[model samples]
Target chain A: MKAEDVIRFCGRSLAGYPLRTGLMLLAMAIGVAAVVLLTSLGEGARRYVAGKFTSLGTHLLIVLPGRSETVGGPPPLLGQTPRDLTVDDALALTRSSAVRRVAPLMLGSAPVSLESRSREAIIMGTTADMFEVRNLEMAQGRFLPPGEVGRAEAVCVLGQKLRNELFGNGSPLGAFVRIGQRRFRVIGVLTKKGESLGTDLGEVALIPVASASALFNRASLFRILVQAQSREAIPRAKKAILQIIQERHEGEEDVTVITQDALLATFDRIFKALTLAVGGIAAISLAVAGILIMNVMLIAVSQRTGEIGLLMAIGAPGKQIQRLFLSEAAMLSLVGAAVGLLLALAGHWVLARLFPEFPLSVPIWSPITAVGVALATGLIFGVLPARRASRLDPVVALSRR
Target chain B: MIRLESIERIFQVGDERVFALRQVDLAVRSGEYLSIMGPSGSGKSTMLNILGLLDRPDKGVYQLDGRDATHLTDRQQAEMRRHKIGFIFQFFHLIPRLTAAENVELPLTLAGVDPVARKECVAAALARLGLAERAKHRPDQLSGGQRQRVAIARATIMRPALVLADEPTGNLDRASGTEVIHTIESLNAEGMTVVMVTHDPELGRRARRQVRMLDGRIVSDSGAGHEG
Candidate 1:
């Protein structure tokens, strides 16, 4: 048969049973839409986390006290206590040529009261270099003054939310605020940064590292942030910090150094796998759709047995009959896939409008993969019914009606 | 021309083997009109199916146009049917979804005839069958006589050498039956070999040659001596 005639014949057959054809198309379309939307959600989450990491500043390394071993068991309750990472260790990291700057962190919660207004806020104690290392911006006044690392400067930078709570809309810079038992002047106010890593940057108060040690009455630092000279210097800077800490602690590698690339790479791998797994789960629906096509096609073969017999009597080969049915299936799948792609895109658009901050997008390969798998499913599942129709006994078929 | 020799067709019903057609020998020349008449289960339909190549005989050497047709492959048999044979059925087996013109164009379309030529042929055939105005009407919309005429148009659209009709007017009223009989008779008058199977003695007698079957055997043939 001519290709166009075959198509027209199949088209007429499908159009003859509108309800059955529409339901099958709906099933196939839902399967494809599910795959594309779920994968896009997974990819969106991956990009969101990656964006957060990029905002944590480039070529950075985090140094924390004690090794975090991932053994397949519960952590030891009475594990060996590692040496404390001090402000001296932070100063020692600055000597490496690969390291651009180091900011030692000391975290503690304290009540900050300005006159009668009081609220408990997290205190972040770091050096002046922290503003550059952590990508913090100043909304008013200047950041911590660049001076001696050990100087116990009685000055602080209030977070945007903290300043709002303490002084409302009024300027809080240069005002004295009592944190715990000591009074410090608010030297700067941070911009309206939201969340980073897990910390709400808009809710903390930044203070000098030495002043935090005196206020919290501890010599040990919480963690150290090191910035490498360039993207390629991150590994070298991590090694230098580890070696410096080990040497300072009398030949013991007590501190764990993690680079930004390593952390980002780990998250990247995790989310990619998650996307593929979700896409795989959605593919099961496509298989179900394929089975539906097979079932319906089988019914169609039986329902149109008389018509098939007529074709055979009029000189259609068995192969032509098979092609007719197979092309019907292929046409259904192709149009269904197209409709599904449109559905997914519309879903993405609606979701993006609802959550504008999220990086909502459909991955390029998802549509291609969905359509390809849909076509394959149609053909593969179509084989049985087509073969049955082709092998029908025309005489017996014609005698039925 | 068509020839059949020692044809045997068996059916397995429960534990017993039933003979549908036994030792059937028949020869038909080009452009001749003939009819086979029999009661229910007399193997007349079986003969038509075997002659139409819709069924295979258990033991026979069948030839059409001097070519061995009994053992031809399924594809080759379909090709032969495409170019050399036409069929009209009792219920006028027209696909309900297609229009009269499209249904008539089926054989030519399957033969890969170009759309323009196919359209012209279908239109001419429909016009010739007195269904020119009903060409765009579906089978369900056409009257019984009109539907049978559409089937006739379809059967002759391929310009086949032979036409086989198995009770073509079996389901129609008296007037429609007479109309359909006249249509096929006209095709036979135009030098196309026509073989029809029917239960109506009146219709069977209208053909120049008549064969009567009983219990899977041909009991009588008026044109027995005219075999090619």
Candidate 2:
């Protein structure tokens, strides 16, 4: 058929049953909008979590203590329970070709004192490599060296928040401080690294790991934090580290290796499942829209049986009869898809405005899927009625009063 | 040529089959004008329907140009109706949604005649029917005489070999009825065969050959033999 004829047919589609077409489009639009809006929100939450983790030096790894041995619970790996990683382990990992830096991380809360001011602060103890491992830069003085570490120097680097609380933005470097009854000199203050994953990074102080071990006096190791040269070497470095750690433990495996890729894959699966759930729920309403289209088209077939017969008697072939009606149905679906796209866009725009940090991510694929669904819906649901129209015996139909 | 042999048309109202036409034989030569007349249930409409190919006789051989048409598929019969046979109904069945010219133009359109040629033919038919001025008016807008003339224009637009008009003027008064009959007869004069069914004896007698049906059978056939 010519383009004009196709356009004319679509016009007929609208004029045939304006109310029904309007209602079906509305149903599709509302359903699509809700799906897009809710899915975007979920995506935004995932993005925010990923962003927080990304801020703490994308390469940093946290290793926790192995499980404690209980009476009848999980078995120990490496033939040991609650195995403690030591400073030597961190040093061993750094020697690998892929390894860029390593830091033994020790964390505890301590009441920090400066002048007459004292505030409870989260304290981190690590080698000078912690600066490179975390991509951390000091706002004042230098990080303590290995000489200072070996001597167990009474010097500390204060986090920006702790420094500000003690001295209100004035230079706090070279100030005297106390942690757990031990006097220390504040040799440096760290550039502000704000809250991450809801843990305030600003309220912290750094010292030598040996000094921390001496001060805390609880020598069970925490974890060895390591960074590889690049993301490409992370997995290889991890594998080598695991093997070495294994060799050190007499070939007994205790540590679990994790990567950002693995974690992201899990998130992908989770989001995918959520997408299916959302799409499935959206499709229920779409199914209702399909039913509405079908019911109306069926009623239309019955009503136009005579008209169909008249056309057939005049020489319209069975296929043409089927095509005309089916075209009408398909046009309805396309209209629905268009309206659905608009509604989805509108919903996304409104939601994105409400939360600046939460981005409403509109994937181009979702609307394309909706359009495909509508087309399939038209063909599937419209076929039966179009067939009915095509199958009507012209003689009987035309003879009707 | 048109011929009907041993025609029987049985209708099942509910349970029993009633033969609307039984052992009915009739014919009309090419270009002949004929009318079949009978009471309501006496099978006049049945005869018209069979001759028109709008229906098939239950037990008979129907020939158009000596081709047995009774065995043709429904689509083939519809094509025959489209290109060779035409119908004019009493109610003036002019497709209320279409203008008079469009209704007149429908048969040619269905035949897939080129649009420009179809338009020329439609214009010629309208001029012949003297409805050139009323072509744009829909059936509801056209007067009785005008609508019947439009219907006649539609029937003859294809220059079909046969025109089956069932009570074409049964719904019109004499002045309008005469105009419609004249329009149809003019086509017959131009060598198109016309077979009409009507209740009015005066109208029935106007045809060159007259058929009288009674009790599901032909009672008399005048002015010609049983083959055309």
Candidate 3:
């Protein structure tokens, strides 16, 4: 038959059962909308975390000291090796290559006095280069130079947020602050850099490494932070730095080099499975939609059995009847796809607005997925009805009212 | 030309075997206007269906123009029916969904005739049936006589040589029935073979050849010597 004839047949068949067709479309649309909404949420959360990590500068690489052993569950004590990084190890790695700067951190939490303003702060002793490695901008004055590190310079750079807390919009720079009987001058105020991986970078203070080492007095470095030329050369730069640290530690492999990209990649691997899991579950809804379509079509065929027999008796082929029903199925899915697209856009907009921190991504793939689900659902459900319609015995069918 | 020799049809109803037609033999030559007269349940409709190629006998030799139709495949029989046989029913089975013109055009369309040819042929068929003005009216819009005329037009649209009409006037009023019978007899006079089944003895006597059946067997066959 001609395409136009088939189209006409399909149109009339659908018109014959408006309510049933409408319900089929609604069911399919719901299934598609679920997939789009959930995937967008997952994408949004991933983007939020990735952005937070990147703003802290791509140069900084963290070397977590020991293996946690258990899969993200818990670190086993039996396989727990102590941290072997020392001040000397940090010094050794820092001096090798175009490794422009490095900082050995010794983090401690304490209550301090800043021009009569007292609050709890995370105190860290590190070289001025720690500011550069963390991409910290000085809002007020200068950070400690290399000549000032380990020289007992009673000077530190307070983050923009900490400065606000201590001085209440006043300049805390060029003022004396006390931490455990020691007085330090706040020479600079770090610029506003928000949280990275949930740690508020804007709330910490950095001082000379030697002074922090002596006060908190750790013979071993808590963690050595390194910065490279740019994000592109970070891997080459990290590998060289790792070799330098290995040699300095008498060929020990205790230090871990974790780059931002690698961490983001790991995050992707973790979330990829998550997205597929949700998407796969959404696929189950499609299967359910298919089943619903099939049930509706079967009922429709049974209702029209006499009409079908009449056509057959008048020389219409079994193939034609099957195609007519399948066409009806496709129309339901097509309309459902259109409705699902509109719904997905509204849902995505709401999700993005409600969770600004998580930038939900509604890629073209999301809507396309809706279409695929609809088509698949239509076919899966439509086949059984078509087959049943085609296989109907003409004699019995004609006798049915 | 059509001839049936020893035609037999047996249908199974539960554990009993019912014979619809048995040891039936007859000849219907070209241009013959003949009717098989019988009461209800005497196999008149079954014989008509078999003769129309809509059903087949379990044991028989059916020759249409000297070719054995009994051995032909279902598809082949349908093709032969499409090209050479026309059927008219008592209720005037003009498809309700189609207009008078389109209902007549169905046979030509099924034969893969081009649209231009189909249009011209359909217009001619409707005009000849005196329904040119009502060509676009569906069956429901037409009177009983007009519907039967439309059915006649559709059956003869393919110019089939033989027409098998079962109780062609059974559903019509006497005048409408007379009009329908006249339309069919005129076609037979134009050299088309017509085999009609009717219970009305007055109508049955009008055929040049009258065949009678009782108990699944032909009891008598009488005809004009020159069927043409």
Best by TM-score: 1
How far out, in Å, is residue A355 in model 3?
A: 4.4
Candidate 3 DockQ, CA atoms: 0.16
Full ranking by DockQ: 1, 2, 3
Deviating ranges (above 4 Å) for candidate 3: A30-60, A69-91, A98-147, A151-195, A200-222, A228-254, A317-401, B30-37, B64-68, B85-215, B219-228
Tens digits of per-residue lDDT, candidate 2, A1-401, equal: 34445456456546756787788677656655555555665666666656665665656555445533235757555454645677666677767887787788887889998767889988777888877776777778887665544456788888788888998967777778899888888888888766665657689888888878888876545677778778888888888788777777667556665555566667767876776677668767777777777888898888766667666655666777788778877877887778877877877777767766664575556667767777678778889888998888766766653
Model 2, stretches more than 4 Å misplaced?
A1-10, A24-61, A67-92, A103-224, A243-254, A284-287, A351-369, B91-105, B116-152, B169-179, B225-227
Candidate 3 chain A — worst ten consecutive residues by lDDT sum?
A67-76
Residue B79 displacement in candidate 2 (angstroms): 1.7
DockQ of the candidate models in sequence: 0.82, 0.30, 0.16
Tell me how much of the true interface, by contacts, candidate 1 captures. 0.83
Report model 3's TM-score to 2 decimal places.
0.74
Per-candidate Cα RMSD to the true structure, in Å, reads 2.6, 5.3, 5.6
C-alpha local distance difference test of each model? 0.92, 0.76, 0.77
What's model 3's lDDT at A325?
80
Candidate 3 CAPRI classification by DockQ = incorrect
Model 3 C-alpha lDDT per residue in residues B147-166, reported as the tens digit of each score: 99998998898888999887
Give a tens-digit lDDT track for model 1, residues A74-191.
Answer: 6558766899999999999998999998999999999998999998999989999998999989999999999998999999999889999999988897899999999999999999
